[model samples]
Target: MRFATAEIDGAEVCGVIEEPFFHPFEDGVDLLEVLRSGELVAAGKRAVSRAGMPLDSVRLRAPLRPPTIRDFVAFEEHVEGVARAVSGTGVAPEWYAAPTFYFTNPYAIAGPFDEVARPPGCRVLDFELEVAAVVGRGGHDLGPERAPEHIAGYTILNDWSARDLQSAEMKVGLGPAKGKDFASTLGPSLVTADELEPYRDADGFLRLEMRVAVNGEVIGRDLLSNMGWPFEDLLAYASRGAEVRPGDVLGSGTCGNGGCLAELWGRPDRADPPALEPGDEVEMTVEGIGTLRNRVVEGAELPPVRPATARPRDRER
Candidate 1:
């Protein structure tokens, strides 16, 4: 079953996406409420059989405002390519030891069809093609074998990036902060895990096709099976020594081969696409999930950088 959060007649509600139409939950119900209720799949089906409106009549929002967002770098190819592009190095040995991830701002998420502002001073705005798992059940120190039970569903994720800002900060040894905090997109709909059971391989990896296109031009394509580490492994690592709550989101970072401009720029044989500019539209699609679309627009002007003040002690000396 697929679920979505939408606004209809000035009211926001969670609903079951029945193609062509949306079957909304009772008045005042939202996706987060449904997720925390732990009855999404069954409730969604019940809602679908009741009254609903045409899907085109409502505005979509990020499926839900995740309580926490943990995005992992689990694709070796993406890591290798990005490392080469930014620092002229190969994948760090440490990356293979364990899955690593960063907690991004959950408040800054955007919905499908929303217009995202190209961060001020950003020259190389890029998009990461990813798939995210939304946690349904909360847990701590979950083992890899049990982690799958906590996953509620899947959705397409676009970790929009400000490359210039990211480059400058990481050189100082601790960031990806302001550069990434600006915005991350998720949505179109949340597809329940059971719906994807058909695609699971013998090794338990989903063999789904993933693609990203910018303004009608196909820029990246990859298969979900290309991920070096599976979602269960990433989730298990994330739950270690910490609690993963309902509504927590775990992203399967950028996919392998060519999923973003940073990777494309590193490849000598492929011509890189121009950096994202105002009015650019980005669409990311995952096989069992759906397409998440966003338009880039100019952002508010940034404050001027302040100059450092002179030290009084040095002047006196």
Candidate 2:
């Protein structure tokens, strides 16, 4: 089932996507509520038999606002490419020892077709193509073998980035904070895990084609099979000493090779493509899931960054 959230009659509701139409749940519940109730699959099935509206008639939102977002660096090629580009090095040894992730702002999530604003003072806006698993059942200290059961569905994720700010801040050993908190996109639909059963391999990894394009021109392409660490491993690792709750989202980071300009810039054979500018349209597609398209727009006036000034100390007489 392809689950989605859409705005209709000035209200946001959850629905099941059926190609040219969307079948909203009869109970008028939203996706987040459905997930928290542990009734996503059943609710989706019930929605299918009801009348649906034309897909073009309504506005779409992020499938649901996640409770928390944990984005993991699961692809070695992406790590190596980024390291070489930014620091002139290969993958860090620590990366291989365990799956590493960072918490990103969940409140800033955007839906498919939403307009993303170029962060203020940002010149090099970039996109990281990824896949994310939405948690279904809450768990703590889950083993790798059991983590898969907790995943409710999957969606395409674009980790919008401000590369220049990210570069400056990381040098201070702190954040990707402001550089990333501005906007991140997800959706078109949330595809249930069962829907992807056909693509699952013996290792429990999905073998799916993933690609990204800007203004109709393909820029990056990869297979989901290329991920160095599986989602189950990442989830299990995430659950250590913490709870993975319903509506929590876990990202597969960027795919291998050149998923973003930062990675492309590092590759010897590839020329850096122009960074995202206002009016640029980005479309990311994953097999079994769906295409998520968004446009970049100039943002409104942002708060000014104040200069740091030391306070004058009282003169000691």
Candidate 3:
């Protein structure tokens, strides 16, 4: 089942999609409510029995506003490709010790068809093509083997980036913060794990093809099966010494070698694709999930950050 939140009659309603239309649930206005009620299928059935609004008649929103979002670099090719272009290096050895991730701002979440604002003062804006798992069941200290059941569904994730700001910040060796605090896209709709069962393999990886385009020209493509680790391991690792709760989102970072403009950035030998500017459209598609689309637009003005004044430190007591 594909669960969604859409704007109907200027009001947002949570519902299920049978395609060509979206059947909104009778009682809830938020998808999180349905998850908490533990009536996913029942709610969907109720929605389907009602009169559905035509898909084109309503506006789509992020499936749910996640409680937390952990974005991970799960593909080796994406890391290596970007690394080689910038530093002439492959992935850091530390990357192999474990699946590393960074907690991004959940409040910055945008929907599939929304406008993605380029961070104020940003020029090298880029888009990452990936998939994300939405936690359905909550758990603590879970093992990889048992983590699969905790995932409710999957959706397209676009970890929109400001490469220039990211590079400057990483020089301080602490963050991707302000560079990433702007926006990240998730949706089209949330596809339940069962809907993706046929694409799952014995190896625990989903065999879906992911592709991304800008203004209709294909920029990158990859197979979800190429991940260095599966979603199960990612969830297990995420839950270690912590709780993996419903509405928590886990993103599978950039897809492959050319998944983003960063892959072509700074490589004089390569024909660099132009960075995104206002009005540029991006579309991402995963074989089982529907297409997630967005347009780039000028961002709001950013107030200048004050520079630190040099001051003497206090003597050790």
Candidate 4:
């Protein structure tokens, strides 16, 4: 069943979708709690039995406020392109050994149709097209074989990026920090994992078609089956020394090559899309789960931090 958390007439509402409409839960209901009950399908059916609100009527929001977000680089081709563009090298050997991920600020999430502002002093803006899994069941030290059950649903994720800041921070070797924490977009709706089972293969890969567009022009496309590591492995690895609780998100990084402009940089084979600007709209769609869209908006100016003064080692001694 498809579920959504949105605003209706200025109040928050969580609902189950029945195509053009969505059946609202009570005035106040927690989405994760509903998923954990293991009765989402039944409740959804019951909700659909009642008259519901039109999907176009309400404003969409991030499906849930995730407790943590682990975004993994799971596609080899994507990394091959990005690494070459940024560092003049091919995919790193270590990437093949295991699934690696970075944590982004979950609290900074934006809604499907929300406007994302270019961060202060940021001119090189980018967006990543990804699929994120929402944990329904909690677990620690989960094995890859046991991770599938933990996924409550799937949603389209846009890990909004500020390339200029990201590049500078990575050079310092610690963070994507202020570059990434600014905003990440999720939603349209949460699709229960069962809905995607038909696309899963014997190798456990999902053969869904993923595509992205900038202002209605399709710019990149790839198959979800191309990922080097699956969500199961990502979740398993994420749970290694920590607990993965309900509402935690695990992202299937940028799909194939061309998933983002950073990946296409200097690639003669692919046409470079213009940098994202205020008023530009980015839309990412994965077959089975619907499209997630966001608009770019001008950023608010921020006060600058004072730079540190250089110190001489001899003087300090």
RMSD (Å) of each candidate, 1 decimal:
2.1, 2.1, 1.7, 2.0
TM-score of 1: 0.95
Candidate 4's displacement at residue 162, Å, is 0.5
- Alpha-carbon TM-score of each model against the true structure: 0.95, 0.95, 0.95, 0.94
The models' CA-based lDDT, in order, is 0.89, 0.90, 0.88, 0.86
Residue-level lDDT tens digits of model 1 in 1-317 = 89999977776788899988899887787888888888887789889889788988899988889988999998899998898888789999999999889989999999998999988778889999999999998889999999889998899899999999899878878768888999989898999899998998888888999999999899989998888777888889999999998889999999977799999888777647888999999988899888888999999898966767986666553
How far residue 308's Cα lies from its native spot in candidate 1, in Å, is 4.8
Worst 10 residues of 4 by lDDT: 266-275
Per-residue lDDT over 61-119 for candidate 2, one digit per residue giving the tens place of the 0 to 100 score: 88989989999989888998899889889998998999999999999999998999998
Expressed as tens digits, the lDDT of each residue in 56-110 for candidate 3 is: 8889999899999999999988888788766888789998889999999999999
Which residues of candidate 2, in runs, are more than 4 Å off?
311-317
Question: How does candidate 1 score on lDDT?
Answer: 0.89
What's the candidate order when arranged by decreasing lDDT?
2, 1, 3, 4
Where model 4 places Cα greater than 4 Å from the true spot, the runs are 36-39, 269-271, 311-317
